[model samples]
Target: MNVLRFAMMAAICIGGFFPSASSDALVGDKLYRNAHIWTGDKKAPRAEAIVVKGARIIALGSSEAMQAHVGKNTQIINLAGAFVVPGFVDNHVHFLVAGSDLTSVNLQSATTPEGFKNQVAEHVREMSANQWILGGNWDHELWGGSLPDKTWIDDVTPDNPVAVRRLDGHMVLANSYALSLANITRDTVAPEGGVIVKDDRGEPTGILKDNAIELLMKVMPVPSAEEMDKALAAASRAALSNGITQVHDMGYDEVGGLTWNNLEAYRRARRNNALKLRVYSFMPLTEWPRVATYIEDNGRGDDWLRWGGLKGYIDGSLGSGTAWFHQPYKNAPDNSGFAVIGSTKLSNMIEGADAAGLHVAIHAIGDRANDNLLDIFESVSKKNGVKDRRFRIEHAQHLSSSAITRFAVLGVIPSMQPYHAIDDGRWAENSIGADRIKRTYPFRSLLDAGASLTFGSDWFVAPLSPLEGIYAAVTRRTIDNKNPDGWVPEQRITVEEALRAYTSANAYAGFMEKGTGTLEIGKLADFTVLSENILTIEPVNIPNVKVLRTVVGGLDQYIADEGPVDLGTVE
Candidate 1:
């Protein structure tokens, strides 16, 4: 009974003084004032007036102590001092392909080959003739190494059928009518793990790696569930205009699929209110027996769509050299990247998803897939004994200080992504060389060995912007300013430890550290205001800050207008 006396006895039992007088008192509406907040509650204290109510956070502090719960129809918001925090919690995303790669054709800034065939001839002149031009992440190391084929986008996709995908969904480029609608020739063959990058006249030069981009993504064209509920309402309005209320998502699937049943398009965007972010899904460990029978019949749901973990793939990525390396690839020396599961079937599926409590994650980018996922999570915690099953690993990136002390003696987590260490520290020391790129994305040596770091933005393979992952974990520098004393500057970290690994170690790796990571009182008024002071910036201006507003539970989803706001009642 002490978190500041349980936040002043839950703000005096939510202001009606205890007896639960039919519990109705959270309508304080809004106050904000003189702002500063940062209450990712390391024992709550930092405030300067909060109040909010009809979505929680009722009463915070000083602005003459929250102007006595400001009422006169509250609604104040004078934050002339900006800064706020919390509302990040991305943890990893893919949010229906980062909102269908925001209406496709980016090709991650096509470097050349006539800028990837003039962006596939302006997405095949605004696509149509049998549609299917689809997303293009593409990255032949930002061109120069050339790779993409089907005669460099088959004369600007001679009548649709593209495919693209390489910024590490582990390869694919496709063209000649998507390799004759996925018949992928030159005697196809290249599955277990994967690779299809061929050329020298054996025929099919459209590349195709990893489970051969599932055979040309199973003949393209699927979308509908109202085109995946309009790409999950434009990926929940670009994840609540980048304050990201909450997401973890990552290959959701409810089975029987040509993909689009992202848990029934997030349960029909939470029954049509068009869900403004709060998912948690994961599944796709090749759909773990229909996600263990839909978490044994809809049990994990609460915070707007939760399907509880499973993910998989212990290898692949590091910008598509298909990561599983212990050695080999210092620029592909007889290559070494394989293992997408098979360490005795990833220790019998992590001892049957830790005896069905489930929560696996896995991915594991190189250092031999983080030493075969810490030797199958320490042989499934010595054959199913360690209880608190928080097990993760996903991109524990290229670790090996004895796999960063087996992620703090096997509690695991490490769900990292600090802008993939400033966008793969520009060609990851040419693919794992400068002495294992000094233990790549180590994040202050996995938080000085106590481990449990979370933060993510593996979104469309980077850029969901948690301030560009807190400016790539406080500037381990490199967005082409070629590593000015950083790239491996002892694993950077500090912008308050990259905002507590993006808000309280990603809300304790998604079990949501008891009601959304931080900001006390009664918790949930999800935050994020900042138009500066990413804790007094200059860590390369924390990727030029700026997210002016973005509350969640306590409404005002994403302000940012900078001026006029009297939209009284729908104008």
Candidate 2:
């Protein structure tokens, strides 16, 4: 019996347990062999070949062992020693917005004030008069610290009503035409939890922060049904190209009808079988009833598209001087930032949503916000008598030492974006002092405290590339190249750890770990093949590693040389 047990262990390591009892009768639909596979399963963490039947992995083992399952019908795919891992799952992304940004003015690379104005001017020339120019994704830090004002582009965009967003999504710069259309002036009082920047002469600077950006919504035009479809298609192609098989789509259009349009668009795509990537959708927390009703009517959707998660914002962002911190920002002595939503209201919403059996994911950027959110999550879970309620804190950017530990204790997942660490690290020290900067984007600390860490792109604000995110987490090198040795070097995590955050950890965060996230039998055959093995290569070269092929549900979604694959016929 002991010898049998040892033999069983070896068989398990080489050939994973078959999905069904009668393993000998099973045959593979596709045989992918001659590859370096990171199975992401602890028991059998490596494999040389995978036998996929339909949309699920039937077996994974040594090339020789898997050959037994490959019958006459199996289509052989020789990987030629390419690196393979579980397909990336971006834990947080505004999907439709990213698609729109791809076609909008390209201002993310504009480093000078002249270049910023030039890009907007060029976009204006292309668009007809009265058309709204949106989705700039401009970074003020890239062109010194001065924020762009309406004056900067008022002359260039005289006819177009421009309302371009800051890269962070916490602020917007509206041109004079847009302000007039919205009826917002120097005298217009900013709404609660928002701010409208004014110049020295008391005139509006066209910069709106937090809730203030909503004022422009009334004047902005709603996207047509056709436009939304195109955006979804564009977004899917982009996600597939990045090797992202799944995304936790944080719903968009907060002011104009609030994601009803976005949700419908996704549904339409799914109905037509147009979705190339899986989506786990989250709606606004304040609208819990709508989401609850949706779940009741649709039964939480299928594996391709799922819902029943609520996303709420506790505060703004650190870059916008709007994160609710415990201490005042070093640059702004009198300001510590404020919560966008009141604690009592936020708690009530969270508790109500929890009672209704919905997943809750709140956005908290500051130390105070994280601490407060943790308290609320703990309270809600306890009151609701917890049953696998995986509460998530989006952008848990800053945290108190206690908050870090409390995440593990309360079983809250920190859904973080690593690129923010490097992007914000450029000037984070100037905003917050060195002391506080030590704890910013502390991936290592969270992992050390036994917290489940997840990674995402926050795309449209940042690029949607998991490789770039992995590089950021492992290297902590700012894009400015100022940190040769890494900016928060102490907080740097290993490449595999970052990959897990992007894959299995994100899968767990979205409650999809059982079906996907690892190259194991009975799991979905969603994985990415890369040109280089990121695990063995130097961390700095990770961003350069190319995604050679991306497969979703047994179908090839993308190929490096040919872009998105059109599976007219499965070979």
Candidate 3:
């Protein structure tokens, strides 16, 4: 998706769909007709046309019925039988980091050893000698099972300090120069929940796993406010172009580095009226006192930017072989994954946040981590009394059969990334046995148990396309294309259900359903126009569907083909 550009007045013809009317006018801000509109409203379900006044959807019905709202100033649009749905609201993302990734080295496709070095070398050649090379989400699993070393990039980037992360963000490969800056030597001891890979002679291999990456983080140069602002702006335009109207920015790692700077950037963006998407952010859970004070001082923000939750981790990512599973990894038999933090400390943070009227969103991938979190939620509810505390378990990837129903019983939101399911499904059989893999990302069971599953793209971890996310959820097919019948096919959901997860379900989880999720009479005019009918299209063809247009608050944000519609921004 390209960065969205705004326009006040322009004309486009779409197969002669629009009537070239009297020079000058329409009363409503915008009129979109001839659409196969998926309203996301359970009561109506579909619509032929929609009339917008300013930022609100004033009316939606048959095209003829909506004509009453049109007048001299209306910027009418004929969809030419295009499909329309509410703009996606991603429930979980590391927004600030995602912004930075957009400008960093492209390594997500570096499948071979030479491919990785060449991509980094190309990026290095464009940068100043002293500039640090970062944000390469390289996946060694894509190639062979071997990991990378600093030696790979040492010759290509001798003058640069490089720290490129694994696709899952749980590990990083730092160049020799970066290791020297972090003072990481052969004698440096690894932290409790982390590992520094070593060579045959016990020398550091320059690969730091999980918490051990802190050594490099401590030495990373903080991005300036100007840099953060630029990144945020880039992210907003990209997201808006993709028809994402809002995002739940799950916290970042370092305070003044990416995480804290993100909060400041969000504030600045909101103040400047540059925040294109509604953002609900979380602070680090371990900083209980600071989080409490910030919440007390700022409260949950308005419709645009909010802070009402704390983000935490129970285990590392599955890609890094540290997901806290009850059983050991099939490939690494003797090792059941370790917890990212102690259980007692996690409980304290959850309790403190809840007591201060905040929600919790913890990253839990393994079955043991899921069970552990369920226990914590149960204790919190028992102690605090039953309330509408929409506590979320991020990446509830692996679950026990009984645990699936517990999500509904306890009213915990499984804020999951379906993209991870398809991505991980590729090599996951080797990570955990086929038996455990059967229950991994149990989307179908969770729905059957009445759990309102919300979907998101872990952005920098995966592509941020909700269309791809929906495709993965509906098909359950692995990216390797090996599972044509779908990986764990029983877990597949319908298109409607997947769409709801991307839009309305996300809004409900974020406490903003009544305002923006669905295309209703009073809802915000945030919607996307697609080239194909997603609801009626062949399930496999949905991923090929392109977003034709995007509108937020009655304004034209993106247009794939500006054929024959009068493109104008509402005043």
State the lDDT of candidate 1 residue by residue for 1-571, as single tens digits: 3553455545532422222213235335777868777786665547776766777776676665555555457677777788888888888777787677788888888888788888879877877786877677777877656677778778777788877677666777778887888787888787777777777778878877776677766666667788777877888777777788888877722111243277778877787766776888777665566677777887888766787687877777766777878788888898878886578877787678778887888777888878877887788788888688888888777877788877887788888888878777888887778998888888888888888888878787788878888888877787888887778887887788888888878888878787777887677888888877777767787777778778878887678777224323110
Residue 32 CA error for candidate 3 (Å)?
Answer: 1.7
Off by over 4 Å in 2: 1-12, 15-25, 254-257, 562-571
Tens digit per residue, CA lDDT, model 3, 1-571 = 0111011111111111132234122245788998888988876677888878788776677777556556666777888888899989998887788788888997998989899999999999899978999888888888887999888899999999999888888889999999999999999999878889999989888889888888888988889889888888888877877778889998568312456568888999888988777888877787667867886787768878888678888988888888998888999989889998899888988987888788788999999999999999999889888788899999899998778999999999999999998888988899899999888999999999999999999987898889999999999888989999999999999999999999999999988898888987667898988888888888899888888787877877777764336645433
- Model 2, 1-571: lDDT tens digits are 4553354346547564333323434577887888899989888889898878899887777777776676656777778788999999999999988887778887888898899999999888889989989888888988788998899999999999988888888889999999999999879999989999999999999999999988998778889989888889899999998999999988754333347678889889999999888999889898898889878888898889988988899999988999999999999999999999899999999999999999999999999999999999988887889599899999999989899899999999999999999999999999989998889999999999999999999987788999999999999999989998899899999999999999999999999999999887778999999988999999999998889889999988888883323222223
TM-score of every candidate: 0.36, 0.95, 0.93
156 Cα displacement, candidate 1 (Å): 8.8
Best by TM-score: 2
Whose lDDT is greatest here? 2
Clashes in each model (backbone N, CA, C under 3 Å)?
0, 0, 15
User: How far is each candidate from the true structure, as Cα RMSD in Å?
Assistant: 20.9, 3.3, 6.1
Show the colliding residue pairs in model 1. Answer: none
